[model samples]
Target: MKARIHITLKNGVLDPQGKAVAHALESLGYAGINDVRQGKYIEIDLAKNDADTTRETVERMCRDLLANTVIENFTVEVG
Candidate 1:
């Protein structure tokens, strides 16, 4: 099985990195940029073929190590 996880900061959290990127974009003449948020994309390969099991395992991984549950949210996709 293949799993993809996208981890991103939750709203209302201060994202300095995202802010920096937005500022850089404006400096580079990219206009109309209101905001920017940075995130992490993770791909994992698993021996299990079941989609439900893969998603559950990946969700645990995200909750345990992949993402900070206090400040970040994650979406998991399995194939």
Candidate 2:
């Protein structure tokens, strides 16, 4: 089982890095920009095919080490 985890800041959290990028884009003549947020995508390869168990394990992994639950959220997908 291959797992893809996307970690991102929750809504209402300030993203300074994303803001900087957006600003740079605007300076480069880009228009109509609404919003931006920085995030991470992690891909994991597993040896199993069960999504339920993988989801649980991935959630635990995120909570324990990969992502900080207080300021971020994660979505786990299998491939």
Candidate 3:
């Protein structure tokens, strides 16, 4: 099984890096670049075969280490 995870900052959290990217885009004449948000993408290969169990394990990983639950939210895709 393979697990794909996406981690992103929660709403209302300040994202300095995102802001910097937005500013750079504007400087490059990329007009109408109103905003930007940055996030993380991770792909994991697992030996487990059960889809339900793999999803549970991935969710646990996100809650424990993959994501900062307080400031970030994570979504998981299992295949």
What are the TM-scores, per candidate, against the unseen true structure?
A: 0.97, 0.91, 0.96
Residues 13-58 of candidate 2: C-alpha lDDT, one tens digit per residue: 8999999999999999999999989999999887778988887888
Estimate the lDDT of model 2.
0.91
Query: What CA RMSD would candidate 1 show?
Result: 0.6
Off by over 4 Å in 1: none
Model 3 residue runs over 4 Å out of place are none
**Top candidate (lDDT):** 1
Q: In model 3, how large is the Cα lDDT of residue 71?
A: 98
Per-candidate total of colliding backbone pairs: 0, 0, 0
- As for candidate 3, its clashing pairs are none
Model 2: lowest-lDDT 10 consecutive positions: 46-55
**lDDT by residue for model 3 (1-79), tens:** 9999999999999999999999999999899887899999999999999999999999999998889999999999999
Instruction: Give one digit per residue, the lDDT tens place, for model 1 in 6-65.
Output: 999999999999999999999999999988999999999999989999999999999989
Q: What is the lDDT of candidate 3?
A: 0.95
RMSD of 2: 1.1
